[model samples]
Target: MAVLTASFFALLLAAAPAKAPNLAGTWRGGGFEIVLKADGSGTIKDSEYSPAEPLKWKASANALTITEEDEPVAYSFKQDGDRLHLSGGDLDEPVDLVRGAASAKASSKVDPQAAPGSAAKHVGPGSCDGACRHYLKCAGQPALQAQCVLACYSEGYGADFMGWFQSLDCVAAITVIAMLEAQSRGLQGGGGGGASQSKECEGCRWDGSSCAWYSQGNWGSNVAYSGAVITCNSSCCGR
Candidate 1:
């Protein structure tokens, strides 16, 4: 009867449901963040500066579903150690998130940029001036300006929303800078012209030749750029 009992227990174990993966923690990537609680409640934010939105999530071994705005969205997910990769269901592209450290705490009252060890800090008074000057210096070179913006953002150069906006003015200053540079060089290329408007480039005007910036309604907003055309309400530069 011992053999019989052992086989019966094995069968029962086989019939039991598999335990869900442990996803209760904060995950962040590319300025987007999600905090999943053990109690199935959560919050998601598109950026470090944006407000969080409430959410409810349930997970199986290989799938995760999030309910927000009274609607349910599903995704196929895979976790490799502390890295989470999610795809499908309202996602145009896959999003990868890294698990926060053990001491990381996220809350409605917290400013994400102010988190411990966060790389978001100011450069004293008039922090925007440095970035604007950098843009002016690199006006003729798109590659240099792009690299400058990327480096500035990564180095935590801006103090607040206005400071961040001022840094973007670096891109705007390209017009005047390019114009003066061309005149000095006796080059035929001129600055300032109407670029083709699109949904992506809203709140920004791009000169046909080079340079683009937030002309209106781009405050405290993320932007996306495709070549010269800028996409509003999305990431500025993926680099």
Candidate 2:
């Protein structure tokens, strides 16, 4: 698989402004019993992680730990003073485990400090601009493209591509490849992004669920490959 390196949202528990130990109790919601105490000890009660085996957990920090056993059994959580927030492992990628048995993570963050009517806020490195972006800009050059093709082929795009693209002459075919890459845009917005299902159509931003195919323009089902059965495009990918 092509490894796309880019900035992505990492799940982490917000460090409470004040840390005491009142996190003890049978707090259950996203399918686990969350417990907290003065000693900073905690455990999420998972019943169906695995048969005959006790539930397991990994402490990511002094306040966070992931508990699970099966396919959809990955998760992390945190507490902002009085509010408790939790997210699962499959939040970014698509998890195709058992439906009823399929547990997934969350796409957004949970800030209990927000007012009841307040909106959500996300964190982490927002974009890649300096070095990484500079490298990708001139990657279309012939000499460079030539070297890349040879290297990529040896690494694989070679044996797999039996067409003229694999020919040495393709070193000068940078424009064609660049244009084709632009058309596909398959790997554009890296890391669990692109044409994933949006709540609305890009044209109308309708937040609709009915996504069509992927056409290019400014929008439409560009995220169809991410298992977006119905993309939320203006005309469902018909740009």
Candidate 3:
């Protein structure tokens, strides 16, 4: 009986997971930053938007749970050397974080003449410049197109716009230009015809207008505009 009890205890010990690493530090990536404390609390700072939010956090063997305003958000994490990879939670894409202090030290070692966020220092005249010109032509209005291109370029390549432009091949440049053009026009293609519509018309009755599209629902049950024949799913159109 004692031998059996000892064997059971040993199995339980073997099954227990290892302790999680201490995550008390500043982690920065994805244009946002997180500061964790030893007391299982943290704040998330969005560099492009709002101020930091205070949250309570709990760490498990392989995951971390954070609670904000009574809602809990969870993320699975793994650390490899100096880098930490986090997935799930509110993130649409996986976030890679580097220790803030270490990142600064590494940045100091880089060449001054090279652009901050881009690899290649100089690109020939035709690369990104050609792409930008093509984007302007496809984008219509000059003022709005310029704004969209600048925003997209800044986001994709960081502050060193010239260096980043140099790094892109013809295909990549064209793709970026197309994306910016679409963004400026507020047209997200896919789904049924006229998939792009104003958000204000979601629940409201679609008055007959060129910008209006049919809301998703049982066919023949309801119709928005007369003679409109497109059927969109609820994912894109409102019921």
Off by over 4 Å in 3: 1-9, 15-17, 106-239
Residue-level error in angstroms, candidate 2, position 188: 49
| Segments in model 1 whose C-alpha atoms lie over 4 Å from true places | 1-3, 102-239
Which has the greatest TM-score? 1
Per-residue lDDT for 1-239 in model 3, tens only?
A: 99999999999999988877777888766444678888888886533232466778878877988796577989999986566788888554576677768856654443332213221223433233433433343333333546656665565544344445434322333444443444335444433245344432233343443233332332221322121222223333344
Q: All candidates' TM-scores?
A: 0.46, 0.21, 0.41
- lDDT score, residue 123, model 3? 41
Record all residue pairs in model 1 with backbone atoms less than 3 Å apart, i.e. clashing. Answer: 200-230, 200-231, 223-235, 224-231
Ten contiguous residues with the weakest lDDT in model 2: 113-122
- Encode model 1's per-residue lDDT on 1-239: one tens digit a residue: 99999999999999999988999998876345789999999998654443467899999989999997578999999998778889887564576677877224323223433332122222224343444433433343323555555655664643653244333333333433443333334323323222322222334433444344433322222333221122222221211
C-alpha-based local distance difference test score of model 2: 0.31
Clash statistics: count for each candidate: 4, 12, 0
lDDT of each: 0.53, 0.31, 0.51
Per residue, candidate 2 scores C-alpha lDDT tens digits across 1-239 of 12322222121223334344344443433223344443444443322221122233444443344333342344455554444555655332221111111112221221221111111111222122211111222232222434544544453332223222211111112333443343335334444354632322333223345434322221122322111122233442544
